[model samples]
Target: MTQQSAAATPMSKEMQDCVQACMACHSICEETMSSCLRMGGQAPAQIMGALMDCADITRMCADMMMRRSPLAAEMCAMCARACDLCAEACAAMPDDAQMTRCAEACHRCAESCRAMASAMM
Candidate 1:
């Protein structure tokens, strides 16, 4: 394919970073959610809900980016909001190592997604 062809077009650095961040956030949220569930009474419904929401959104955003969907930008914006909420929930439990890690991942993912969304606009 020629340089100007669609197939020859590479993803911008921000988009690539957002995609990677989304995938990482998905994995972290899933793991954190499972961990919270395993903790039984330690995990509250709100935290669990946030984790689940973050996991699902991140997975969808990553998939959309991978497919080069036209709606990926919107999806990234949604993912950023979800990630921020999830990070806040996780960060509330400061003593837990898993929660802390999940919060950090979520925050980074949110930043990356925000950048991607702005770039796509």
Candidate 2:
């Protein structure tokens, strides 16, 4: 699409990308948490809980964007911050490739969300 056409649109590529990442992160985190649970004591319960929280928030943020909710910008900002912290926590557990991937995904999603939120400002 041409710049003019795209510009006229409310959502930009960055916003779309962020939403996609947020969705992916949500699914991945849920899956990862399940896997961790299956591992029983091997998984950190507190960390898992935090991951679930982050994923839920991330998904909520994406949902707001999909509906073009009035609170989308605020939600995105909050999700971005949550994602960043979650990513950092995941990064600490380098032993699990899933965690690492989730961390990276969250980080990327956070950046995109933040950018989109900034655009709305």
Candidate 3:
């Protein structure tokens, strides 16, 4: 088959960076969730919800982009929103080192996802 006929296209640098950011965000979210759970009643339910949503969305977004799915752009947009919410939630507990780190990761991922979504438009 000719190169043009292949199902997959090469990923641009922006997409690659976004994918990396998504994966990183996913990892941090997972870690933060565990930390929250270990903190007993210290972490609020809202924060836990945001972390869960961000983790799931970021993982799915990265997978979609890596596979060059037609819906990858939409996924990225959703991922960005999730990341933003997660970041805001994490920022609520500035005293916690894990929360601070997770917030930073979420912010970076959100920025990258936003850029990727715009570029795909």
Best by TM-score: 3
Report the Cα RMSD per candidate: 2.9, 4.7, 2.4
CA RMSD (A), model 3 = 2.4
lDDT of each: 0.89, 0.82, 0.91
Query: Best-fitting candidate, measured by lDDT?
Result: 3
Worst 10 residues of 3 by lDDT: 1-10
Candidate 3, clashing residue pairs?
none
lDDT of 3 by residue, 7-113 (tens): 36678888889999999999999999988777785789999999999999999999988877778888999999999999999999999999999999999999999
Between candidates 2 and 3, which one is better according to lDDT? 3
What total of clashing residue pairs does each candidate reach?
Answer: 0, 0, 0
Per-model TM-score versus the true fold: 0.90, 0.85, 0.92
Count clashing pairs, candidate 1.
0
Better of 1 and 3 by TM-score: 3
Better of 1 and 2 by TM-score: 1
Looking at model 1, the pairs that clash are: none
Q: Write the per-residue lDDT of candidate 2 for residues 1-121, one digit (tens) a residue.
A: 5645544668767778888988998987787788787878476666687688888998899888876776888998998888888888788789999888888888888888899889867
